[model samples]
Target: MAERSFHVARLPGFATMAVAVFVALYLPIFTLVAYSFNASNSMAVWGGFSLDWYAKAWANEQVKDATVRSLVIACFAAVISTAVATMAALGTTRRRAFKGQTFIYVMINQPLMVPEIVTAVALMILFGLVKTVTGIHGLGYLVLAHAAFCVPFAYLPIRARLEGMDLTLETAAADLYATPWATFRRVTLPLLAPGMVAGAMLAFVISLDDVVITEFVKSGGQDTLPTYMLGQLRRQLTPEINAVSTMLLAVTVVLLTTFFLLTRKKD
Candidate 1:
């Protein structure tokens, strides 16, 4: 008798289960997007399709301010987090195994493991003390909080890229009397670009979508798009909110797709 290989796909009802899971996960999202174009102001009613909500969202000055603020915070956070993450990745991966390596990893990813609410509360308290001492308040707190939160996200991809890199090129450069910095600049950096880009995009998306930390850390009048949307939700329901959500969803989808393409190995 021939030995049989097991496959999860071959398990009973696996395909059905997978389909059900995807539908459960995405059905609400699909519904939201579909209703974004509804002509009616009511969220629950299905009206004829129209672009009125999109136009309204575009004309809303509050939306514009929130959108710009969100973008600025996300851009700054992505740059700061990605740079720190790249350095961390190099430090952790380029050296031989050392004592407390696991500890370092856990520390780096502590935000990911800890509840977001916990992190938010901690940041709120810390920022509150700083504000009391300095009597200064600004968007800087949100940027810093987001950067810190996004570090683990950026680090993982860069570390994965570094681990998968070929050391042969660096060895060859060294044999040719190239300095470590020179080799890294000329060789390692180029190869690491994709991972860094992917990491940055992921960080950008996380920062852009962040609500808990932003809500906790922001001063008055510093609402980002997500927080603004939340505030609107508290006040009323409208297709304009749905339209804004759909636009954000589209942007997130694009960035994530690009990240996937950049990080995927060409086989």
Candidate 2:
């Protein structure tokens, strides 16, 4: 008899475990989304469906400011992290294996391995010194901190893309007397685009949703959407907060969907 393939899904308890895990993960999110539509002010009591909370969140000047600030910071962090990650990926993968390659990867992904609170505290201290020395208290510090934190998120996808890429086209380009820059711009970049986009989207989402680092690095009056929501949670529990959360969830879902489509294998 032929040997059977091992399949985790075929295990007796797999389906039950999977369903349990999913419910555990999504039940709260579903509840939150459901409450976002609640017409009543009371979080526990359902008062029929309504859009009042959404309108309230939309009209709140603080919410608008926080949303805009989050967008700005996420955009900058995505671009900065993606660019650095691309270069780093190219440097590491487009050459022969060498000493410290593993070390380089470890250093690149240090943010992912280290506790986020530790990174946040380190950034807080570093930025504090910079602030005291330079007197440059601005959003730049937050932007840089976010970009640094996002780098590993961006790097993994780009490096995977670079590794999976065929070297034949690049060799052909070189054989055809194409310069390295031209080869990269024409041949390598187009193939790498999907991964770059996916990385950027992931980085953007990470930065947008970040609270710990943003909380530690931000100056007074510099509240991003997540931080703003956190502050609101501390002060009060409202369906308006739920509405804001639902909207944020929608944004995250849309971006992740697009990222999935971009990175999916073309069959």
Model 2: residues with Cα > 4 Å off, grouped in runs: 1-6
lDDT of 2 by residue, 151-265 (tens): 9999989988889899999999989998999999999999999999999999999999999999999999999999999999988898999999999999999999998898787
Pairs with steric clashes in candidate 1: none
The parts of candidate 1 lying over 4 Å away from their true place are 1-3
Residues 114-226 of candidate 1: C-alpha lDDT, one tens digit per residue: 99999999999999999999998888999999999999999999999999998898999999998999999989999999999999999999999999999999999999999
Name the TM-score of candidate 1.
Answer: 0.97
